[model samples]
Target: MVRYAQTDETRPADCVIVLGAGTWEGEVSPVFAERLRHALDLYRSGLAPKIILTGGLDPRNTVTDAEAARRWVEAEGIPAQDVFMEEKSRYTHENFLYAGEIMAKEGWDDALVVSDPLHMKRAMLCARDFGVTAYSSPTPTSMYRSTGAKAKFLVRETGCMIVYGVWRLFGVRS
Candidate 1:
């Protein structure tokens, strides 16, 4: 668990999967921006030839997170063809669920999953549930840096982890 919780940012996979964070008024939040920054670094390093961005339209925003991410990455000079967008997931569980389908359709089997540090474990587990092989690649420069915030995220992750375990135990796939 300890190792899984750590970010293996250098792992070379078929693609870099950037999980969505909240967007404010159609703009990527700082949290999501940091995630994209890490993924950009991963791409620039030649770790992967492609990136997959995921998220549906959040309640407070007019545009989908995936679309916003696509724009951002394109602005960064990553060609549109190298970046795939899945804009139908509204939660972490659906992120992997929808991404798995996209992966299968696109023939992407293994990926470096990018998200906040505390989210890697459960996200990886969810990735498995959806039939996708993924590695943890949490953002090293996440704004969730304060000790209290980290602790809170850890606790929340614990609950989410247990819930996902139960869901999997019961044969719930989504």
Candidate 2:
């Protein structure tokens, strides 16, 4: 997990997949914004011709994370037609599954999966399970910059990964 987090396996792909992190008051959180920024960079660099934002409506937020991110990127000058949204995924695996539906519709076969470093390992696992050809492109910087914050995220991700592994073993896909 540590090794995967430290690496950036970004490459040219059919599209860029920006995993949804929670939004705050209808705006992208700093953590989510970092992911958006990295994906935007990848799009601008010609790595991909399109970006797919994934996230569903959280009960706490009025708008979905994908919608918020789409809005943010559009404001940053990305054309509306180039941005797609999977506005029904509430977690990592569903992110890929629903995004795959969009990919199929758009004839996109592969994607660069974008997320924070600590989240990449699990995100990639989910992407693979969902049968999406994905390459990792973790944010260059994380919102969890402090030692305590990083540790907390690591612990949480470790637990989440373990649970996901067990679920896979049982064929309990969501």
- lDDT (Cα, tens digit) per residue for candidate 1, span 1-174: 446768574678889999999788878899999999999999989988899999999777899999998888888899988999989998788998888887888887799899987788788878877878888888888787789887887888888888878888898765
Instruction: Show model 2 residue runs off by greater than 4 Å.
Output: none
Report the C-alpha lDDT of model 2 over 1-174, residue by residue, as the tens digit. 877897788899999999999999999999999999999999999999999999999999999999999899999999999999999989899999899999999999999999999999999999999999999999999899999999999999999999999999999778
Error in Å for residue 56 of model 1: 1.0
Evaluated at residue 78, the lDDT of candidate 1 is: 93
Top candidate when judged by lDDT against the true structure: 2
Model 2, backbone clash pairs (residues 3+ apart or across chains), number: 0
C-alpha TM-scores of all predictions: 0.92, 0.98
The TM-score leader among the candidates is 2
